[model samples]
Target: MVAPRKYPLELRERAVRMYRTSDPRPQIKRLAVDLGVHPEALRGWIRQAEADRGERDDRLATAEKEELAQLRREVKELRRANEILRTASAFFAGQLDPTRPR
Candidate 1:
C-alpha cells in the first residue's frame, strides 16, 4: 500500500503552477522554503510535471508510472498463481502414482 502524501494535491499543483508561470524561474530550494515543503519533493514534482507535459524524458509521466505499477502487480499475482498450480499438479501426480504403496 502506498503511504499518504505529506503535502496535499492542491498545494502541489499550486506550487507547480507558481513555478511554471513565474517570469523568472525560482530556485527549487527557495521555493520549497517559501512553501514549507522539502526541496527534493518540489524538485520531483517539477520533474514529474515536466514529464507529463512532454518537456522532459528522464522520468515517466504519472499515467505511465501508474500503468507500470499495475503491470508489476499483475505479474506478481500471475507468478504466485502459477506457483500454486505447479504445486497442485505435483501433489496430484504424486497421489496418482501406482509404483508406490497406497
Candidate 2:
C-alpha cells in the first residue's frame, strides 16, 4: 500500500505554483520557511516540476520514474521465479538419478 503523503497535495500544488508564478524565482530555503516545509522537500518539488515540464534533462519525469520502478519490480519478480525453477529442476534431477537410493 502507498504511504500517506507528509504534505497535502493542495499545499504542494500551491507552493509549486507560488514558486513558478513569481516574477523573479524565489530562494528555495526562504520559500520553504514561508511555507513551513523542509527546504530539501521544496527543492525536490521544484526539480520534479521542472522535469515534468521538460525544462530539466538531468532528472526523470514522474511518469518515467513510475515506469522505471514498475520495470524494476518486474525484473525482481522474474529473478525470483527463475531461482525457484532452478531449484525445482535440481531437485527433480536428483530424484531421477538411477543409483542414488533404492
lDDT tens readout by residue for model 2, 1-102: 899999998888899999999979899899999999999999899899999999999999999999999999999999999999999998898889977774
For model 1, the stretches where C-alpha displacement exceeds 4 angstroms are 100-102
Candidate 2 least-lDDT 10 residues: 93-102
The most accurate candidate by TM-score is 1
Tell me the whole-model lDDT of each prediction, alpha carbons only: 0.94, 0.94
How does model 1 fare in lDDT?
0.94
- 8-61, model 1: which lDDT tens digit per residue? 999999999999998799998999999999999999899999999999988999
